[model samples]
Target: MKAEISQAEKAENLSMTNWFSLLGLAVAVLLSSLNISIVNVALPRLASSFSVPMSEVQWLVVVYLLAMTCFMPIAGIWGDRFGRKRLFLFGIGLFFCGLIACIVSESLTQLIAARLVQGIGAAIFISLAMTFVSDFIPATKTGTAMGILGTTSAIGTALGPVLGGYLISHFDWHALFYVSVPFCIFALLLLARQLPDNAPVPFKLVKSGRFLAQFSENPALAGSLTANVCVSAIIMSTMVVSPFYFTDGLQLSPAQIGAILSVGPIVSALTGAPAGKLTDHLGSGTVVRVSLWIMLLGCLLISASAFWTSVPVYLFALILVTAGYAMFQAANNTAVMTEVKEGQKGVTSALLHFSRNLGLMAGASVMGWLYLFTSTFFPATQNQPATAFGVTFLISAILVGLAQVMVSLRKGR
Candidate 1:
């Protein structure tokens, strides 16, 4: 047990790395990001193929988030108890299974179910990967390494729409799921070579549970967690309705919407590293405060654009919104990690992940409900859909703005 505890604290004496570990970490991060946006472009195709309403098609997206959210809290604890490497490998295996299942899925139900499984895999890996990085990398090098990871994840999210669009147009949507298999296998193999089993952490299940229950004991944890949920909810709420607004309202094609949606992630990926450095220099608090304002401003910009009937204005607003979100996410993650005890890091990370998932679920559900309400009352033809979506964004902006205020409240003795 003593040996196990020491192993769990492996990074206590860890030195900075070269590039191999960095590359491996990037792969893991990208996989997580891919899960988030990979299905966006496929949504239209999936909806058409499954003969489902656009609103119902969102279940495929939200179900995955629900699974990820529910499982995120425990993933970190499992990492500590079972060894982070073990958890990571298991996650990769699960991801591969999910990919295979997706490729073989025949119905909307099956596809959504498979995505939930994929979300579980992502929840496991993402939480553990963050913990592993903090454990094995030197503190001085952490920001840079994390920057790489963040940027990679953003890039994956950005690329997914364009890549998924191409794949769906040329091949079939199944190809999207199948294509990930090789990468998952490659990632698993490389991870095995690069990561050691090490020793397990002392597993006092009761103690761990008790610790988890005390999540509210840390004010920063609570605040950061709330902030995470709000930000993710706002972002996902926009995502849920954005495609429809672009394609139906603006009379664009799936390819065109894909191209537009693609811009945000690309900007995020390109800007994330510098944003990280900026966070390191300016402090997480400063970054978080600024990002929140920027995001809120973007929301207002979009709201105004909705009223003005300007597509270009909307696109410009979306770019700012995405950039601001990326900045906040990077900074908020760093702050959350710093807020908890070393032993509680995994649980905290998991909590943050959980919050994001829950936020996505909440945001998407609210948007869907609002869309229905608006469509029935205002009719589908004009910009009623946009108005419905715009209202959801306004609400999300308020929630996120409130969260930012909470983050601003400093904890004291």
Candidate 2:
């Protein structure tokens, strides 16, 4: 009875700390997400300032993604080797440092370099944020915690363009970089105060060549990771092409494009809490099954809607797609981390991150190439880009559908 009472007190303290940690991590994830979309609005300004070609200026975004992509897997190991808190603090510090450098950058090269630094920090912070939740929160509450994190990310992605537009109009484009600094500083402070400095648990490093195969030794982990990568690929395929569909094909203005794109993230943010509750009640399996079906349906709807020239129809299609992705992502992430062994949390989380980013990179590169192919081979048709995008979505859907099969085939824990 005395031991039972002690365990209950410990549980209560952990619950409070978990909530605080979630708040801190969400802010960190939000700032990182903000940097991704905010700069899209500022690209033209950046181009004019440096007198660079649009293609050259695009590197500012591309480089950041590539840097993050390359660095993300490494972050997982760092979290496992160092404590999650130490790595978390370091990552946030690096993000702000990079932001500061970006604000003062004079040349395009300098800006790209600084953004790469920011990407490295972002990769570290994001992976650790997920792993940290698994550390502090109980298994049952994982979905809810992830839901909050997902919502914060959605808010950042949605608000980034609107905020960037305002700042670029009244202030120099550089202010966009400076804007995120204070929020990150606060996140770092909160994390330090609230997060426990639990010592790192040691483990043998898994090689990239052996990473997937060794991890696949656990059927559940393999299934979860596979599903995550497939869903991520589908989401990114639509996102990468949507701007062209809106601006070039539909002839919307930049602000209108921002508004249209904003709808998905807005709905995502709104639905996050509910999705969390569902995950908590239904478990990650049910959540993923339902979410994937929604995503699959949305993909088909949007692909068909792309044939039409109506703005409202397109926006509605996008909202459905985004909502599906939002729910799918939160549930999928919760599922992925929970399937791993407790001591393997960092590596498992890292492998999952690596897989997702790897999927995005693969999707973006392959889908972009397909778009270019269509533009060259089918240039006479006005619907060529949509056709190309639809084809990509169909492939993505099939992949995700296969993932569903794997999930169904997966046995008990």
Candidate 3:
């Protein structure tokens, strides 16, 4: 583990020629990013395909997230135990295999199972993609290189909706799965050609285990983790609900919903880099508090749109949520790691990743439950789906407020 971070420090001293491998790494990151968001556009279509209710079909999202959350720490351990090339290739194979399964699935249960496989693959890749890429670049250039890759994530987030929208609009949902094939093949070929034979970090899990002691004792770390979970939960819950809300409540087409929803990621992409820098200057705690306020406001705006069904209000709300999440993540992640001792960095990072994925699973699962329950209670919510979704968002906003208070009360950083 020390060897792995030491590499990041030494990256600045490497020859420029070593950067050639970054192309392959960037492709991997782009693929991961696109896969993450593209699936959102398919939720409504999946419900139709499986002949399931909006909430029931959400198992596709929830299952995948839970699988990813479960696999993250294991992936990190295995990557160290095995070689990066071998581990990453295995992950790719698993992902494509899962995609194949998804394309061929006959029922919602089968699709959810396939998605679980895909999520495992995603866990492996996402766990190592940035670190793997940094292995080939100079330490001095690592930050900029990582930031460039981060931008690709934003681009992918923006593209997922629009691309998924187009594919589902013109062809079948299968087209969306097909889209990943070229990138996967390209990444596979590139990694095979470019990566080194020897492992960069000494394979170890015991180091990651040490953080459990500190994490349990550290109030600040615990608070940061909780805040991140809540924030991520809110963000993902909105994603799960938006497609249904727009389609059922607003009577919009998949294409229209995709186009409208793309606006948030676009704003997030634009603000994300600057936000990281701002976190450095203002301090993570301060920025995080401000971000929670912005997101709370955003959630309220979207909640209001249930009554009005105003596109303008929705977009405005989306901008706040997207931008707030972008800023919040940068600061929150920085805060978590900065608070940890050097020896505990690996565990802290793993815990942070786990918390983030857990948040995704919780957000989707919880909001899905909330929406279904609200619909059952207020039967009118069946016809006006937005009302049910609006209630969910309001509940999420309350959680965020609670998160802010938690952050405020934390005794350390």
TM-score of 1: 0.90
- TM-scores for every predicted model: 0.90, 0.86, 0.84
lDDT of 2 by residue, 1-413 (tens): 99999999998887788788789989997897788767765555666778875457667766776777777767876777767788879988998889999999877888889998998888887777788887778788888888888889878878776777667767877888877988988998999999867677655543322344545576776777777777666655554556555545656555656676677778888988778878888877788788878877777766666666556765676677667767776777887777666456666666767666666555545654555565566665667766665665666668768878767766354
Per-residue alpha-carbon lDDT of model 1 for 301-380, expressed as tens digits? 78777777787887788878878878887888877665455556667667767887788787667765665676667765
lDDT of 3 by residue, 1-413 (tens): 99988897687545433454666666776776677668888888878877877777777777777877888777765555555568777888888889889888877788789989988887787665654543554443443454455455666778888898888889877677777888888878877777655443443443444445656667677787788788888877766678877777777898898898788878877877677677766777788888899999999998888767778998999899988887877777666555444334334555666777788788777876787688666667435586787788899899889889778877444
| Candidate 2 residue pairs in clash (backbone atoms < 3 Å) | none
Model 2 score (lDDT): 0.73
Error of 2 at 187 (Å): 0.7
Candidate 3 C-alpha error for residue 44, in Å? 2.2
Rate residue 78 of model 1 by lDDT. Answer: 75
The residue-level lDDT of candidate 2 at 204 comes to 50
Residue range with the least summed lDDT across 10 consecutive positions in model 2: 205-214
